[model samples]
Target: MTTLDKRQRVANPTYEPQPYSVTGYPTFRSFYPYYLGEHAHPVCLVGTTISLSVFVRALLAVLPLLSPAKQFAALRFGTQGWKSVGKLLLGGLLQGYVWAWIGHFFFERNKPATFKHPFYSLLGDLTLWKEVATLKRRP
Candidate 1:
């Protein structure tokens, strides 16, 4: 497999919770682990997976439109049509928003790192989704 950058490799690294201080906001490195921990619930994982998949598909669709070369490549690959993908993405976004709000308002009841540390949040979402899937398969 191709090697990842250091940031991506440790995208979901564990956190070392220090005392809440009056300094600036925690950096991405400090927030990612906490984000992962918050997504331990199976529902959260499922919601995040659905959301991210839609987000990525939407991004792919939009990217081609912005660049002719990419548009041609997408057509060649039979992935040029994007209206359905756009609708799916919208639905996914709504679902993700609901899940995130639930986590913030009821479960975690705290700020989510996705607002500040998007990359790590995505990584944590995938990791948690995998864990939840594996656990479900076990007897």
Candidate 2:
């Protein structure tokens, strides 16, 4: 399959850190190609999607607890509702980590890039989803 072929090329790679810092790029224009290169393995795409989904789920859980919404929610559904929201946020966090670990260790057989470059890796994850979803990049 085309997807499997693409993954094989990136699976057994060496780490040659680019001479320039990932954060050193003044604009995303200079940084995006490097980000895409880092995530060429299909597993990275899977892990990033899982991670971002969890984040969005957590945000959805937390949004109801903010300011005016918090008061309205409390009055409408009481403490039990707030407890469920907290649980959802915690679960999202746990699931995100677990999925990321699985993707790196089992699927990619490589350490997560996020450990070294948090900001750029995150942007890579988010934009990678867009690229792949839009068929601009292949997994």
Candidate 3:
């Protein structure tokens, strides 16, 4: 096909996002073991911890300014409130992405497993935090 014809045709017109799932292990318990293995690198531990810490700090800074009821209100109701939350969310996401990419590419020298297992990876992160807090694991 000519370049012009290719440009005119729709690319992936039927594209749709599929639900995330792990093979074999349908539950978090079944997947936790594999998740831990992926995050064995020290960099992954520190990266995810810093990312989550930033998010919590941001949320705490803005919590006092917003009433519980206003939390669910539209962004227009309280611009400051929404902006604070937005900043936290964006900052946390950016930090997480950057740290994960750096850790995987430089420290671990492997592609992040999150690419193939998002949900499980997320849960694994939280589980890691729990383990650290309970003195079951070190970061």
Candidate 4:
């Protein structure tokens, strides 16, 4: 299992924060390696995939309400449609975080990258999701 072996090599037994997560990087290219390092467990990668899937579904839900012909006319159901969109967004966000956090706490045995670098962590999560979804990266 080279995948697990490689991930194991990346994982540190100590749960202490790594120096990479502590400092600000000038570009996402630098932060991406650290992001991949944090998801050292297969479960962590699975969590990321599920989280992004939920986001994709949420976007799909809103697309139906959008009117491509005009601006400020996205809601076909008027105010009610806006309310549904809000709830869908909120639900997706909360659910997605829960899965990611569970992966960190249980399988990874470490803190999430989001704790130190929110922006890059988000980018990493999306990137991981894309890779996994497209079968470009193995679980």
All candidates: TM-score: 0.49, 0.55, 0.65, 0.68
Query: Which stretches of candidate 1 lie above 4 Å from their native place?
Result: 1-32, 40-42, 49-81, 136-139
Candidate 4 residue runs with Cα over 4 Å from true position: 1-23, 67-79
Per-residue lDDT tens digits for candidate 2, residues 59-90, read 66555566564444432322555786666656
Ten contiguous residues with the weakest lDDT in model 2:
10-19
Better of 1 and 2 by TM-score: 2
Put down candidate 4 lDDT per residue, 43-139, tens digits, no spaces.
7666556656666666765765675655535423325676876776677777778889998888777788787778888888877666556555655
lDDT of each: 0.57, 0.59, 0.63, 0.66
lDDT of 1 by residue, 41-96 (tens): 43555567678777766666666566767444552213435665667677887988
Best by lDDT: 4
Off by over 4 Å in 2: 1-31, 52-79
Task: Sort the predicted structures by lDDT, highest score first.
Answer: 4, 3, 2, 1
Report each candidate's C-alpha RMSD, comma-separated, in the order given. Answer: 8.0, 7.1, 17.6, 6.2
TM-score of 1: 0.49
Candidate 2, residue 125: the lDDT equals 67
Top-down TM-score ranking: 4, 3, 2, 1
